[model samples]
Target: MRVLVTGATGHVGRHVVAQLAEAGHDVLAMTRNPATAAFPASVEVVRGDLLAPASVPVEGVERMYLFPEPRTATEVVARAKSAGVTRIVTLSSGAVTGGFDTDFQLPVEQAVEASGLEYTHVRPGDFASNTERLWARMIRADRVVRYAQPDAPSLAIHDGDIAAVAVAALTEDGHTGRWYDLTGPELLTRREQVAAIGDALGEPVRFEEVSPVRAREILERQGGWGAENAGFLLGFDDYSATGPSFDDVDWSATLVPSPTVEEVLGRPARTYAQWALDNVAAFR
Candidate 1:
């Protein structure tokens, strides 16, 4: 099967492309800049911008791994359908499962579902890769990580694990119209996560608990995902900046570990410790 993977250069998209190529499928990796993106030689790279849906190369593509771009999702799905694409596996958010996501990934899932094509929504919770983005700089500069919620539990799933589930949905039958909620095999606190990274590095990393306001300020200055999501993660703001704060909800139920990843891939989900080891160089 020939699969077109949009956002092919992104964190999860890269894995999806690699896995598909390794599985001997024809993989079309769509990226904004094909010149810089790297993939297996067996995978073909193409230029496509989700914001501009017309550029997506769907010719002879039977399935797609869609990256959520809510503004153009309907048009993108329509074009894929018209191009004879039979199935779609969307990279959705676990927020939709908790009803907190309406403006973003939800729309993409809706668009694909409405297209009359076989569709599966892969909704993953806190990504283990986020730790690399949020703490790698701090750890590299000075083996220390400061956070507002040192005890906050997270089921940070590996990006590779998320892609594995997505690949299964795209290549296998009986996954159509299914929504798979993925998470790590176990729950780890903020301090524990830092400890895991420290273990991977063979060095002791200190975890300092800071006030939410101070943490937010640091995150704002750190930039990237840290800056963009600082307010919401710190309980001062939300996705729209108008919704209720993060503290308003009881997140205990959401913290429980889910077996969906293991159930889908027929193996145990990767742990944060393994993820930390895999990405130890970034911290170093």
Candidate 2:
């Protein structure tokens, strides 16, 4: 089968491309800057952006791994359908059902589901890679990591695991109309995650508690999230300080890891400690 993957430069998208190529499928990686995008030599890289579906070439592409860009979903889907595409796998967030980051993710998922195409939603909770953005600076500058709600537990997932499930959905049957609620093997608190990173580096990492207000600013500055977006991101910590974050408040109910990933991929989801150990060089 021939497949087209948008946002091919992203962490998960890159992995999806690699897995599909390794499966011996004809893969086309879509990017806004094909010249700068370094896809695998075996895969063909094309010029396209989700924001501008008009320029995205859809000819001969049988399937798509759509990065969630709800604004242009209809156009992209129509273009794909017109070009004889049958399957679409979207990279979505657990926020739709969990309401963690629903404001943005929900609309995207809705658009894809309503598109009348065979679609599978790849919904992951907190990403294990977030540690790099949240704590990499602190760990590199000093051994101190500051964040709100150090004890608040979350089932952060590895990006590669998310990609693995996405590849399965794209290439295999029985996955259409399914939502893979992906998560790490274990739930760990922010402090625990920092400790795990330190353990990977064979050093001691100190954790200092900061207020949500301060963390919001840090997220906006360091993570490049906007002010309101940063507030919503930090809201997770604030709500944790009081109770569960969403209107449907049930922390213990959602704390357990989802088996969908392992069931679909035939392998256990990666653990946060394992993710930390795999990317230990980033801290140095």
Candidate 3:
């Protein structure tokens, strides 16, 4: 299949492009800046931004991998439809159905549902990768002062798992019209997550809980931690305290004969410990 992937330079999109290429599919990596895109030489890197779908050349594209953004989702979908794109696998947020009204994610879901194409919504739970962003400062400082919610359990899925599921949906047929809620096998709380990293590093990591207001101030000082995202993170933390009644569906059962992270990476999926060990340089 000739596949076009938007957000090709992003966290999840990078893995998607690599996996699609490894699967021997013709891959077109679309990014705003072709010069900076790090896709392999085999990939046809194009200068296309989702914000401007006109920049994309989709003449031979049969399937698309979409990353949801507040801007241009509807326009991009419309352009893909006109260009003969038949199927789409979108990266959606679990928060959308879990009753979190983040305007950005909800509208993208609406657009995909209304697009009239063979679509599969990949709604992954909180990504374990989010910890990298959230705890970066703490890691650098060797200490973290958080909101003190230790018991808020989250099923954080790995990015490669998300890409594997996306590959299956884009290349296979049975996945169309299905919304797959991808999650990790185990549930861990924010404190437990911190402990996992500490255990992985063979070092002690400390957590101190501050008032929400103070936490906001701390996040604001960090570049790229925008007010909206900071607020959303705090809100999500509070929501986790109450827990999400994420329906009764057994996600593991649906993923029978499961697509292992190893299958996607052609190696074992990095556990929290492995990820911590590998990325220890960033922390130090």
Q: Which candidate has the top score in lDDT?
A: 1
Model 3, residue pairs in steric clash:
none
TM per candidate comes to: 0.96, 0.90, 0.81
By TM-score, the best candidate is 1
Query: Cα deviation in Å at residue 4, candidate 1?
Result: 0.8
Q: Identify the runs in model 2 with alpha carbons over 4 angstroms from their true place.
A: 99-103, 223-228, 236-248
Off by over 4 Å in 3: 143-147, 236-271, 274-281
lDDT of each: 0.92, 0.82, 0.73
Q: Per-residue lDDT of 83-108 in model 1, one digit per residue for the tens?
A: 99999999998888887787889889
Give per-residue CA lDDT, model 3, range 61-157, as digits (tens).
Answer: 9999998875788888888899899998899876565655356666777787799999988877677777777776776675553654666676667
**Candidate 2 weakest ten by summed lDDT:** 236-245
TM-score of 1: 0.96
By lDDT, is 1 or 2 better?
A: 1
Residue 46's lDDT in candidate 2: 88
Q: Which residues of candidate 1, in runs, are more than 4 Å off? A: 240-248
